[model samples]
Target: MDTSDYNNACFAGISSLFATLLAEESQSEDCLYLNVTTPTYRGSWEKLPVMVWIHGGAWVTGSGGGLYDPKHLVNQGDVVVVTINYRLGVFGFGWHQALNNTEGGTLKGNYAIRDMVQSLEWVRDNITEFGGDRDNVTIFGESAGGWSVCNLLAIPNAAGLFDKAIIQSGGCPAMTEAEAQNVMDGVVTDLQCTGTDAEIRSCLQGASVEDLQLAATGDAPAGVNLNMASVVDGQLLPDHPLEVIESGQHNAAEVILGTNDEEIPAPIFIGVNSSAAYDDILASVFPSPVDRESLRQHYDLWQYGSYSNATAHLQTDLYFRCQSRRLAGALTASQAQDVYLYEFNLPVSTVPTTHGLDLLYLFANPTPLLPLSYDLHRDMLERWTSFARNGRPSGQWWEPTWHPYQTGNHARYRLGNILGMEYPHDDTGCDILDSLPNYRYMGEPNDWFMTRVTPLIGLLDWVLDTIFPSE
Candidate 1:
């Protein structure tokens, strides 16, 4: 939307970044466009590693074109960075009885995820022309984008598309099949459509796109609006992502998984109208008794007279921390690939490391309004670019080297007024997650609690070390 803000940061040898439109016509038919940033127009030299970013918007909103500005990553990382736009909302993931009777009926739901897979397939085919290494590509995203990365790792067709991944603030503990189907049935009832898959498909195909959009976002009988989200369609997605990861049945791409210390505060930037509604939503989603008391105690002990920050604590733990740990553990169990875990503990005053705060650093912007935030951004660029160059981030203070996430010695990057490492042990937040209902894996459950859970707990040790330095 705002291209002018990106003109100066472009580097030499880096040609004009452009968006190309692609389309597929068939059962898996949809728009397949991608925005690419490259160092040169020719495909003569050896292929450069590629970074494909998937935007985050609950799988309902957000366009890859809207979320990224290629100036920094393209020029600095020296790699082709492609941001993609996929189908969203109902057009992306609604399921109906009408489609069930058609060929490949088992692939009814999960259209959005299919679009993502298709986008990757396009990259695998076309990135070579943009001076990109087709054989060495990394997929990264935040929030729903992170969820999409996890989904990509699980999809059988997406195996060789990426060599590495970085997921921030999302995980595989997404909606279950029964839960998703219940939402689907409710949507059908709300639309007053014939229950048959074929009839529903025909009716939807003929309906106005606006009408479909409204129906998808509208409140349904289940009290949860069913929009564009991946489903357990027996074909595209045969099982939950966690199931696949735990069973070691996923792609063998190396992974970097972590979350912000405070992820919930970002929504406040959208508007305050939904504060009460969101509070209820948080309560419903992360109902806690065991962890709540322990968290309260920890807060009181650590930041005495800081009870107001409790809300930020609860929100981050529920939406970011817990889910991140679950995903890391599941991937670690795969043991088929490398998994690196991290936690961004850059505290902004009373707010714990809020959501999207990490974006400032990752993007490496030069905005003057947030200077302290920008310095950290520079450090992030150095580390991340180093990783892009050699699969490992480099820096004097923030180098990412610790025991693997399963060694009970989790390493976190503490980026705030300064950047350094902090190992939090005795936190036991993942154990609290394990105590919850439906938290256990159904297929080949991995004993992640014993292996990877303590590394996160080690964070408490880091926090303590910071408070009482022996020097």
Candidate 2:
């Protein structure tokens, strides 16, 4: 959270952002729950579409009960919205055999993901009582939650659980076993509990939350990075999502996905005051001197007013914009159905447009994030719920017709007033990003492979999980 907006002016320096920003999610590991927001319970006459929401806090922190409540979405859309609490950090994703100490069952690190799959199954079986159409389920989430939905789309167990999908501002990163094993090893070293597997398990089971937090966070470089992401375990996540999509192994779930205009900025740009500071950004994402100059001449970030504004373009494209466009192509490749894409550039009260801003308008919770006119709010509801209810977003005559994303058209509905057809965002810049080998984003785009590269990758991952069950 070294980014300036996160540490300082999150939500445009709102009183709520400054006053009550830091908070804890779970007090204990026993908590696995979900909240359902439904319109007045209707018997069987009208079955409403169900929208399952997964909150995102980098897979380390976050709860369904956050600033974005479901009352607004449920009331406005007349659909059932279920917000779930999946396991986070070590409790849900810890990949150590020592902890499983069970007599008959194996405990995998993806219990959090399993919790989500179970929740979807629950909704499918029981949501009808809550006035929901179990068959027309739409799974949507922002950030990590969005990333989770992307993984779920590829996972075999998650197949058929939902008919429609909405991924906002995130996509799955290709993961390997060695990478995950390295993280687990760091965690165990941090714990400093030396003994047999059983002994370590006993110690960890009895360890205090404060002590476990250290192991959960992992060590430098890899340790300091987001450690608790979903591992590509052969059983739970067989392959990288793009590989699954490109191979056409993925179910034909209609997708509506996109990223915000300005997503979270890179830490390198934080507190950057002058051209001297931006050189650091060029150093990291652009390694070669020639490539660095190309980027510098392309964007001309030195002209930006501050660190956040200057570094915004590269960071936004690196982490979100390009990643999303790459995923959209993978999702729709060689498929007959058109995938819907959108870009949330609507200028609002909260720092124009940034990551998670689109949610402020759609969420039920009241805060100082953004204020949308009721008319605009209604329009968004129509678009989202219409997609959930049917398969497309509907709009009034005033708004331009939002066409499905076609291979050639690259059609996108700019989610704003005076809507118009827009081309894909920064494909050339993304092509530059995809070209770099060391600066690989999402492990070199799985869609490029001819054979089953994901399974080959997953095989090594599975071996690590099996051999180092304790890790």
Candidate 3:
């Protein structure tokens, strides 16, 4: 039996309330690190392919190498896996006009994205010693991590760092300079640090992490959502992700991107108890009377049987499914390289197929929670590793011929109890949702969808327990 070692070094995590709930160890501001997992190897010239993982906590919370045990992926796939930690919340993504002025108004904000690129640079320089093929690297992530991978594709400096990417349930969204400055101004006001540019810079540096965290998240008006996201600073990130991809300026060549059958389920729905509540949310999301009517008609209550389910499905389409398709379309139009799409339709008893559920079968952690079928587990590992090894995600004894996602095609591999290619199941609603001008990516100004969903992030803990009952 070949031996494998999974190194998950604990580092200071992001200082946010969400981080507090998710962290088992103490969290501080000084949190930039990464973990590498490798399998046993002999003294040979051949090295294994590498896959770097970026964890997801909505850009504010979450660290690498804690819950994601890559031992099984390393050993079974015979590859090296690297998990990384980047700054979160204000420390990582907070931006101010004064800070930019202090530094001569260069690319400001998006420290988290820069940290991720730095990790890739580390892998390029040092992964050879760990028996990995740095040139044959594939970067993959879920949620924010997936979002990071998508944003990294748009970053000019991140070019040639990795060869392939797999983005799971992440949208490609970026904020304009004005939006980012507004968010930072609010934080500065909360901290009571209004004065000269020098004084503001000093205040930001001297403030405690706790105070920063509270200032970042506290006392916001009822409708305002405090989120840390990538900024279109015109230097680091040259343009919006969609614009970059369409202009053939993106860094990715081979990609596998998709979402779960139901990325946001009813449990996180929280307050939508009736049809009226659902309509109210729709009005808020699509302020235009015509757009709201189109959506309401598309997600009518009779079809879904209840507003709770309708709202949940509508959100899944708007935030995850449709956005993912938009990214895939952009990739297909820009490059000839393979772009595969998928939908994790596998449903567990008493559980809705939600975000991050596909990970359980991919990593196949041997902790003995929900025992997935051997066929399903094997299929996921082979498909993912196959993509990492070669650009194509085919070539297994028991596997069917998988197709690359193509432009004008509405087909994606359905990863469920019965796996095969299928048509876009929610196209009607996505059609209406995508038509809305404000539904551009995720970080657009005045986007209320994130405001509605951020509170429900805490409920993800319950979703985790429901999936892994042993937790």
lDDT of 1 by residue, 1-471 (tens): 543222211011000111011111111223345678776343346677788888765565556544476657777667788887666545666554555558855456666687788888998998888788788888999977887898888888787888888898876634555555555565566567774666776766776544554455443211113234576666777677878887888887778778876675533322212435333333443356454455444434255333334444554665567777777777777766667677775535764566666776776476656534655666666665555555666665544343346646555556556566677786565566556655544221111111111222235435534664322
- Per-model TM-score versus the true fold: 0.76, 0.81, 0.89
lDDT of 3 by residue, 1-471 (tens): 222432322222233444556774456444566788887553345888999999886776667755787877777788899998888767778878878886556657788889999999999999999889989999999988898999988998889899999999988878888988888888898789979998998898888766777677644322123366788898899888888998898996799999988887876666666767776777767778788788879787788877767888888888888888888888998987889998887645456788888888877653446746667777788888889989777647666767888656667987878777877545787677667766756784236452353335535545644654420
Model 2 agreement with the true structure over 134-201: per-residue lDDT tens digits: 89999999988998898888889988899888889887764565666566666677777669888777
lDDT of 2: 0.67
Assess candidate 2 and give its TM-score to the true structure: 0.81
Question: Which is the better candidate, 2 or 3, if ranked by lDDT?
Answer: 3
For candidate 2, the per-residue lDDT at 369 reads 53
For TM-score, candidate 1 versus 3, the one ahead is 3
Query: Scored by CA lDDT, what does every candidate get?
Result: 0.60, 0.67, 0.76
Candidate 2 stretches with Cα past 4 Å from truth are 1-26, 41-44, 97-106, 218-225, 265-270, 273-276, 285-294, 302-310, 365-369, 424-426, 437-471
Error of 2 at 3 (Å): 38
TM-score of 3: 0.89
- A best-first ranking of the candidates according to their TM-score comes to 3, 2, 1
- The alpha-carbon lDDT assigned to residue 8 of candidate 2 equals 15
Q: Is candidate 2 or candidate 3 better by TM-score?
A: 3
